[model samples]
Target: MALKILSGCINCDMCEPECPNQAISMGEKIYEINPDLCTECVGFYDKPTCISVCPIDVIITDPAHIESKESLLEKFKHLVNTDRI
Candidate 1:
């Protein structure tokens, strides 16, 4: 599944750099995760790097974009092949 950043973000700038797919970015008030670009690190890591680096533990699975592991892997492959990673 894709991940989403909750509202408690301090904008510490930790998660943004950790995201392998470049899915995290500065939103109007806090860091945001783009579901379309998020694969939960399926292709780059065993776990999500952004979640590991986030200090406040505000990152969580996006219920709106629920996806299976195999689906996430396919998305990762697509990002890599399309040079969007």
Candidate 2:
């Protein structure tokens, strides 16, 4: 699943740069993760970098956009190369 930054975020700016897919961005009030670009770090690392670096641990799996690990890897490949199958 994609990760969501909860409202508990303290805007510490620790999670944004940690995303391998560049999915995290500064929102009006907190950091936001783009579901389209998020892969839970499946293809890039053993765990989500954003979650690891978050000072407050506000990141949570997005139940609304649940996806399998295999699918997340596929998405990561697609993101890096659209021509890839």
**Candidate 1 lDDT (Cα, 0 to 1):** 0.93
Name the 10 consecutive residues with the lowest summed lDDT in model 1: 76-85
- lDDT of each residue in 1-85, candidate 2, tens digit only: 9999999999998888889889999998888999999999988899999989988788999999999998999999899896354
Top-lDDT structure, candidate number = 1
- Backbone clashes in candidate 1 total 0
Clashes of each: 0, 0
TM-score, candidate number 2: 0.93
Taking all chains together, each candidate's TM-score versus the true structure is 0.96, 0.93
RMSD of each: 1.6, 2.1
Task: Give candidate 1 regions above 4 Å deviation.
Answer: none
* List of clashing residue pairs for candidate 1: none
